[model samples]
Target: MYLSQVKSNGKQYIYLCVYVGTQEYSTRKEKRVYSFGETKKALIKMKRWKRKFNEFPNELLNLGCGMENLEEWIRTIETGITKTGRIFKTNVKRAVF
Candidate 1:
């Protein structure tokens, strides 16, 4: 996973881009991006994410932080950053619809 920053309408946004494919198909790997909000808050969360799994290998095959676990982590984030980003309640239906 890596942190990606983008600028839009004079504001900066950060995202956590995770490669969801195995190394066997490096050329055609899939990617999922989870938003971390604007620069100030996003930077703080990005640092947290890096520190969370920094020990894992490029393939994320470490015993504690395997690829599967990483995938689950991403899922929870997409469902709601409150599950991983920050502490706050979200209106799920609105977010989805």
Candidate 2:
């Protein structure tokens, strides 16, 4: 997601461009643009979108700070193993048992 500014007929406008993956095999990507007219509301929306995308998740494997919640983490692993009937690779440096 990104923001773009455009000028038309002496009026400047802000646009939010979101890259959406296409379902069809022929087209790999598509752009979804949302126009927020030059107004205070547009600024607020842009800030909100910027905040949301700035914290986007890049990977699912790493749980940096969440490692502190040992019990919940253990439960999650156990539940996943039970449901999938397979063991997942974990980077557990120490084990109580």
Best by lDDT: 1
Candidate 1 vs. true structure, TM-score: 0.34
lDDT against the true structure, each candidate: 0.48, 0.40
Error of 1 at 37 (Å): 0.6
Write the residue-wise lDDT of candidate 1 on 1-97 in tens digits: 6544567897766555666677574674545445657755544443355567564445334224454555444444344444346532222222221
Q: Extract clashing residue pairs from model 2.
A: none
Model 2 agreement with the true structure over 1-97: per-residue lDDT tens digits: 4334456686555554456777566473545345555433444433444455443223211323222222332432333332335543232223223
The deviation in Å at residue 65 for candidate 1 is 7.3
The regions of model 2 sitting more than 4 angstroms off are 19-30, 39-41, 44-97
Candidate 1: which stretches are off by over 4 Å? 20-30, 44-97
All candidates: TM-score: 0.34, 0.30
